[model samples]
Target: MDRKGILAARVSVFIVSICFIAMGIMRNEHFVVFKKAVKICLECIGLG
Candidate 1:
């Protein structure tokens, strides 16, 4: 590929990697909040 095409490809890959990493971090946070929320909801429903 030409230089510009190669550069664009590299940039796209970098962006994708960064997005994946960010989502992974957010996923962890989401699970933590999700677990707590589920517990609270269950208690409110008198199942816990």
Candidate 2:
């Protein structure tokens, strides 16, 4: 990948990780919306 592509990929992964972490916290706080979002993130990350 080119430098720009690598940077974009890194940014994407970082954003995804942040989303997952936020969802996890929301889940712990009893937010149903976050639970679904977390599931989607897991699938996207190939962990679901």
Candidate 3:
């Protein structure tokens, strides 16, 4: 593919990913992910 087509694909993918992320945030999935990550880190440190 040419440079312009590659750039357009990249932009479209970015926009789609942003929309999915926004949906996840609206559903509060980010907090759930953050909690899981924190739990894993604390367990690794023997704090949980």
Candidate 4:
């Protein structure tokens, strides 16, 4: 992509990430995320 398109893409990624973070914070979803991440990590290590 061109310079402007590249910048827009990067900005969009940041905006979407921020939105998800805000939603998670509002719903206290991040707490559950840790458990899910632990499961994922365990599966990755072939221990799950």
Among the numbered candidates, top TM-score falls to: 3
lDDT agreement of model 1 with the native: 0.85
True lDDT of residue 9, candidate 4: 99
* Residue pairs with backbone overlap in model 2: none
| TM-score to true structure, per model | 0.56, 0.55, 0.70, 0.63
lDDT of 1 at 5: 100
Clash counts for all predictions = 0, 0, 0, 0
Which is the better candidate, 3 or 4, if ranked by lDDT? 3
Better model by TM-score: candidate 2 vs candidate 4: 4
Ranking by lDDT: 3, 4, 1, 2
List model 4 lDDT by residue over 1-48, tens digit each: 899999999999999999999999899898898777766586678887
Deviation from native of the Cα of residue 45 in model 3, angstroms: 9.1
Error of 4 at 42 (Å): 7.3
Top lDDT prediction, candidate number: 3
lDDT of 2 by residue, 1-48 (tens): 899999999999999999988888867854665566766577678886
Ranking by TM-score: 3, 4, 1, 2
Candidate models: Cα lDDT each: 0.85, 0.81, 0.93, 0.89
